[model samples]
Target: MALDHSLVGVASDPVERTWRAGDVIVYALGVGAGAADPTEELAFTTENTAGVELRVLPTFAVLAAQARTGRRLGDFDPARLVHAEQAFELHAPLPVDGRVQVVSTVTGIADKGSGALVSTENTATDAETGKLLVTSRSGVFIRGEGGFGRSGPASDDWRLPERAPDEQVRYRTRPEQALLYRLSGDRNPLHSDPAFAARGGFDRPILHGLCTYGFTGRALLHALCSSDSGGSDPDRFDAMSGRFTKPVLPGQELVVSIWGDGDGAALFRTATDDGTVVIDRGRVRFH
Candidate 1:
């Protein structure tokens, strides 16, 4: 069935979500924290490290803002939908353990000839204090569900810089990376079940797009937001957004190339070791 355009601009009822220190740590590990060196990133991966307070990764906001009570887009095969873009802005450093009231809205539906891009925005607020915590925006492309004759909004004026990147960071994913990342609330069979993946036209299970996003966020956190002492400072990491241009398989090395855009912002692209651009049109703002 085609997507329900009437859902656009409709906000869902608030849903409350709670997380603990353990949940935060699991999310860290799922995203490759402490993988290179067990001793590194203790603040994010350990809760009992003395003199090192437990901290949350800024990208965790993506999971924190997810709400299952949102309006249904339509009744189409789930395999036909894929994440196309993601963006999130943090209002403050996320607490190690907290409760949030999340509300999601279907922001827009754009026709792209071959497919439809359904965009959504979610806001997670501190349940107790009522303060806004994070705002997340994402788009999903549903194959064979377009051509309704409605044009979408104009695209952003994003372009790659001509010069070389200021810095580049690379990290390798484990063969079991998708298995680990799946523990953090995303149980999509496309990332785990080989048979389900085959239905999606993948020879094997593919890594979660958000998992790749988390890896890229880690590079940005350390390269641009680390403290003078070389410790990752989550507070300095503000906002990030990117488009998923290709699927990433497990155990592939990710190379993040960043070009500084001046005034505490940058543009980036995440590619595989062989130079396949998996995530493109990336942008980030930091302090």
Candidate 2:
């Protein structure tokens, strides 16, 4: 199961994806949006009645408009696939209604003695106008797919901040959060069907990693800045990168721990109630 370095830079089949109004709203709620005030910008369920033109939530790019033709992990093996890291870049906010096309490619494949890392990049564009909406980069570790003839470098070990965090925020997820989040477009059954999860090594349906990302954003909003306009801009969180260490079940309490790294840098980590660290070796940079 080791990484096939030959697969590096292999561009997968382009997939076309589209989004509807309802899909946008459901995605917003899945990530704990509108939980604090019910009047927040992400309260898509009610904000539709607001005066402004509604735009699809940016994170929805991960799910919506994806070209379904890419090579999936099933082409390899499910039990060996481990989501190692992920990141996103927003070129522009997507219009609520539109068809989009995404081009996904396997950018890098590295083999270590113990495991392999596969990196993929996805670029989404408006199908009609060809406007670039977002680009995503993801890396996954295939646990048993290593020890090939080649001796690639191992995954780097991260060093967390030594100082105690200056702030911590806790957020609660809805019972059906995964179901709601999946509506955004990621229909990975692992997050929906208990049978699939148990087979994948979980007890029950698990939350989407991006859902965890959204919840972390909410916690960051609380820990780093005020919800008021004078405090910070909602769009400030333009980029986020993190490593996924564990699965997050629905209704779990995520306690986001943050430490100021001085000179504009900050560190973060998210853990569940049972002391499970869902996100680790995390860092956030702001404008």
Candidate 3:
């Protein structure tokens, strides 16, 4: 079905979401935390132990993103929808367990002739205090659902730094990474069942894009925000925006290359250990 331009600017009903300490640990595990070395990411995957202060991964905000924005956009086929791009801003550190109000809005829609780019923006706030926690921006591509009328918005000028990375981090993705990540709200067959993935043109189940995005966030935090004394300081994170350049298979070792712009902006690229860029044109900014 074609996209109904009128659906743009519509807002979804405000919803309340609460997470427990266990929930945060599960989310951390799903995104590849502590799987290889528990000591490295223990603050996220393990808690209640001596000297451990549980913390939530900044990218977890996307988990509370618009769950039903596509349906509200129009009668577009769910099978053809693809998460095209994602951007996020963190205002404050998320409590290990607390209640938050989530409200989603259909911010904009762009017709690209062959498909429509639907944008949904989600804001999660402290349920009681009404303080904003995170703002997540998402864009989905609806195949064969464009050509109604409107032209797309102007493109962003986001570009990588000209120099090589100042530092790099390498992490190996577990073969069951997709299986673990699927438990964190996204049950897409493309990231789970192999038979279902074959139908979608993949050798086996692929990793969820958000899972990869979370990993990048982890890398950035470790590289740019870790305290000189040892632990991570969440205040260094401000925003992240990037493009999904290719499909990342389960078990692929990923290398994150980071370049700092001296102004708290980080330009980065995630690639296979073999050097195949998977998430390109990435940018991370910090407060």
Candidate 4:
């Protein structure tokens, strides 16, 4: 079946979100924010003598609203929906306590005969200050949803250079990684309960999808951004995108390899400690 050209560039409903201090902390914990130490720098749950407001975790960009008002995934076969790729760009630092709004729009639609690629963009802005915070670009491949002849302009695939990686960064997860990441309000039991994981063909709880995204961002920041600059400057980094392959367990360490191909574009991969590639074929565009 061909994609339905009528559905190309179709925009979805806008999603609005407001975050509080507690919400910020929980999101951090879900990603193993304080797992390294009870007194880690990113820990927000600890009793504080300074009584400062909680700092927002950069990964919170994933939870921003999308236009789902008139759309329901169940309308299409559930198995047809697959996350293809995701990328995010940050413009300003986000605060823990603030009102935010997300406006998502369809950016691309490609028909791949048996499957369809639907690309969406989520733009987040601070409601109070009216500051543009972040923009998240995502694509989902729906296996059975194509054949309506829907496809827009041809998009370019990110190119990876043929060379060895210059730097590799790794992060280890605790057995309760999913438990911690779920505090961000993505309580999919597949990452927590053993029975649920078994039902999903997993040996144990898995990490949140966004946790992996966070790890990728952390790796990119380490590889591209000036670590000495504390990751606040977006000019140092260009862009990043990747697909999630195998689910990562909480206790696993993700080794990410990044290489500079000049012109600020780089390539990266996240693998397991045993050298199994978890996120294969990643590309980063740097400034």
Best by TM-score: 1
Taking the tens digit of each residue's C-alpha lDDT, what string does model 4 give over 210-240? 7877767656764676535353333455456
Off by over 4 Å in 1: none
- Worst 10-residue lDDT window for candidate 2 reads 225-234
Ranking by TM-score: 1, 3, 2, 4
Q: Report the number of clashing residue pairs per model.
A: 0, 5, 0, 19
**In angstroms, how far off is 263's CA in candidate 3?**
2.6
Cand. 2 TM to true fold: 0.81
Q: Is candidate 1 or candidate 2 better by TM-score?
A: 1
* Cα TM-score of candidate 3: 0.93
TM-score of 4: 0.76
Model 3 per-residue lDDT tens digits across residues 41-142: 888888877887888887887775434433456675565666788999888877888788888887888888888888878988888999998899988887
lDDT of 4 at 197: 69
Which candidate, 2 or 4, would have the higher lDDT against the true structure? 2
Report the Cα lDDT for candidate 1: 0.93
Whole-model Cα lDDT per candidate? 0.93, 0.71, 0.81, 0.66
Error of 2 at 166 (Å): 3.5
Q: After TM-score superposition, what is the CA distance of residue 100 in candidate 1 from its true location, in Å? A: 0.6
Q: Write the per-residue lDDT of candidate 1 for residues 1-287, one digit (tens) a residue.
A: 56888889889999999999999999999989999998989989999888899999999999999979846799887887889999999998899998999999999999899889999999999999999999999999988899898877898988999999999999999999999999999999999999998887789999999999999999999899878766989999999999999999999999999999989999999999999999999999999
In the range 1-287, model 2's lDDT, one tens digit per residue, is 32446656767766777777776777777787777677555434443565644544445656653566635543555644667777776676566666778888878666665677777888888888888877888888776666665543555565777887888888888888888888666787878888878877788888888899878866665456443544334344455567898988898899998987665457889999777899887776554
